[model samples]
Target: MIILHNYFHTFPEFPPECEFKYAPENVSRFTEAMLSGNLRIIILSLFSFLGHYGVSIFVFVSGYGLSKCYDHSGESKWYIILRRAIQLWKWLVPMALLLILDRYSGYTHFTYAYLGNNKIWTDMLFMLTFTANGLADRFIIAGPWWYFGMAFLLYVIYALFLRKSSDKVLWGIIAGVWTLLIVLSSLGLDNWVFAFRYNSIGWLPVFCVGILLSRHPVYISWRWISLGVVLFVLSLFNRYLWVVSPILALFPVAAVLPLARKEPLQNVLLFMGKLSAALFVTHAFVRQQVLAHDQALPPEISGLLYLLLCIVVAWVYRLCLTCFYKKIHL
Candidate 1:
């Protein structure tokens, strides 16, 4: 999304039909469908259904990787947390630049794009403080920001509370909290703003599963196929049951990573994993750029073109990040 937007902004070959059309109703429904879908399928469906949710797997895997590395090295807590925060800054700084350019280029409407101009303070908080879910609630709705923000929050919380906690106690507490949130969401008793706004609670379950995996790795084969099957079945139902989707999404973790491990394709998977974040942020922009340049393409073709661009943008962005990381001293 980010790539398309950036491309179209600079090219300006095809102007999109720009009469403002709000899709809040559709968004709300899709959000619900995401939550209620089948366990494994929800994970896979996002890759095809909307494409954004595929990165959630990366978020979990990233958390798992960070935790695993920290455990192996026995790094100081302060140092580890600082490093994680720095990684975030590494990505966000560039994004901030793009964000500013995106606005200046007229690819994005700063006023309406950000929930009225007065909410700049809130948006900055989300961007700076890592309250992505909060930002989604206030300005955007259910974008890739939520995954990064929520993952940051989980890392902080886990480091403070569960890093050295007994596995039994930590897993129990994690599952219990997830269960409570699920109950609240199902009952509509959740303080949606508080739960999602600060990135305090929405994705705890997924991250917690990753945390658990850090302690107790699952052993399995042919997991991705199983995950694909499950994800497909779940898409038929719905993805909107606030608490169910994340829980269902966990099954793939058991299946997908193990399969990846068994395959002798470490570098390729790592490359894809590393670029996952950049891809998540850029794909939407790429799609928008295509639409802007060739407005007459049918929506169906536009969607296909968007998917292809997502892959291209993600790969390109990954290469850029790799180069930047090597060139910079940090």
Candidate 2:
């Protein structure tokens, strides 16, 4: 969804006949572009909205995986956080250096925290520290690194507070937070805390859902799927719900993901899932380079090629990392 979402916006071409002026942010223009009778453009445009599910799923997965593995034995919370931090840093640091090198090689005088001396380092620091939530939605140039920061904080919250809480207490927190976010959003508040799509608190409800579900697995009956579909449909009609669509976006994905439970397809998914981290960290650079040199081709064709390049790059990255670890171990 992240790859496709970026591709949809990156291609940025309307059918030549349509003559519609559309910015990606303009809802009316997006509707007009979708109605332009071009199937590819319509599909890409729709995915730009639906693609939000990717982040929600990721957050849920993080929570679910941690809950499953976390030990109640005599282990320090800070030590667990350090392991997670190192895991994330191995994937992130190379990109930060590459971006720095790409942007500058000339000498500049250094200053306190390197704030004004070079603004680029600020981005690098944020990326490195997993605090890119400080950059938030303004981070088009920084790639999709905000999730790392928000995720790191989420882990800290889990280690310090959530791990010790009872399931009933967890449910209460989820309900209270969800209710508060909804009410704040309904009031059209502009605070970052109210932005359910971006902040950690906004995502807390779904993250807790993952923890709860991990503790007590449930069968997805037809009735549950029906309810999910109904709520998702109803969410689209209301202003506040639409703003927080990704919070419930998991419903549709959960409904669809079960279909790929068969053999070959399942293996293929697992392969790509291993490469997902590298793909997320490096795709912006691939997108930039692919578009820079390949403008002569059609948007749909170029977009597909961009995807191919991303997969290849991610595969190469994983292979190199695996070999590096192998040499170290040997």
Candidate 3:
């Protein structure tokens, strides 16, 4: 779904006026599609819906896994925070070096694509350390790296508050936080990309759903699936709710629970799951090379080639990562 946007969202046939429309405003492709009356854009916008939901599911699953493992006990809060921080930066440090090298060497243009100013290092340190993503979006060396900042923010929230809360207190906290968010969003906070897509507070509702489910495991029956579909459909009706479609989009993953026991399909699923973060972290670099240099290739063929290249690169990335860590003995 995300690859649909990454590889195939070039609406090259747009009228001249709309060619570079969304760039100045920092609006997303989804918003561009929503506002554009072009039929092709509207149809392709479904990919936006499905693709962005991946982050929501990722956060939710992170919350679930944390709750299941810790259950509000064990490690000290700072220890948990330190551990998560290491995990985030271990990837960022190497990836940042690769990006800087790419920028200086590629065209020898001395122009950094997303690295912008040298302040990226400072920005990343503060962002990754604190996950104060409101300021952290400026550290947009890789566009998707915003999620790492947000993920750490969520982790901090988990370590500091969530790990100690009772179920009732947790639900109340979720409601209270969202109520504040709704009011702030009504006052136009959603216009900021950070608040709209990268804020831990905005993401908390979905994450809390995972925590609750982990605390009280539920059966994934057809009725629950039906309810999930219904709520997801309803979320599309309202603008604010529509922003959280990821939460609603999460229900369908339950339908795939049975796949864990299947044959090659299970192996495929596990492989992708293990490599998903590596794929996301590295794909933008691969994409820059793929899309920029795929000269005059057919769109369908180029798209497939790009996808294949991403998986291959991600596998290599995984191997390199494991070897590096083993060498360091961390």
- On lDDT, the candidate that comes out on top is 2
Q: Identify the runs in model 1 with alpha carbons over 4 angstroms from their true place.
A: 1-56, 102-122, 140-142, 190-200, 220-244, 252-271, 318-325
Instruction: Summarize candidate 3's per-residue lDDT along 15-127 as a digit string, tens digits.
Output: 11111011223234445666788765565455534455667788899999989877756789899889888887776667767766755574642223565466666765665
The C-alpha lDDT values of all candidates are 0.54, 0.68, 0.67
Give me the overall lDDT of model 3. Answer: 0.67
Per-residue accuracy of model 2 over 216-319 as CA lDDT, tens digit each: 89888878877877786666545555544555677787787777687788998888899999888877667767767788988778878988998998899778
Q: For each candidate, how many residue pairs have backbone atoms clashing (under 3 Å)?
A: 35, 1, 0
Clashing pairs for predicted structure model 2, backbone only:
130-149
What stretches of model 3 exceed 4 Å from their correct place? 3-45, 104-112, 116-118, 127-132, 136-139, 185-189, 192-196, 259-261
Worst-scoring 10-residue span by lDDT in model 3? 14-23
In TM-score terms, which candidate is top? 2
Candidate 2 accuracy as TM-score: 0.85
How far is 293's C-alpha from truth in model 3 (Å)?
1.5
**lDDT tens string, model 1, 196-276?**
523646555556666678878866456665765476445434323333444455455555555667546666677666676
Query: Against the hidden reference, what TM-scores do the models get?
Result: 0.67, 0.85, 0.81
Q: lDDT of model 2 at residue 53?
A: 60
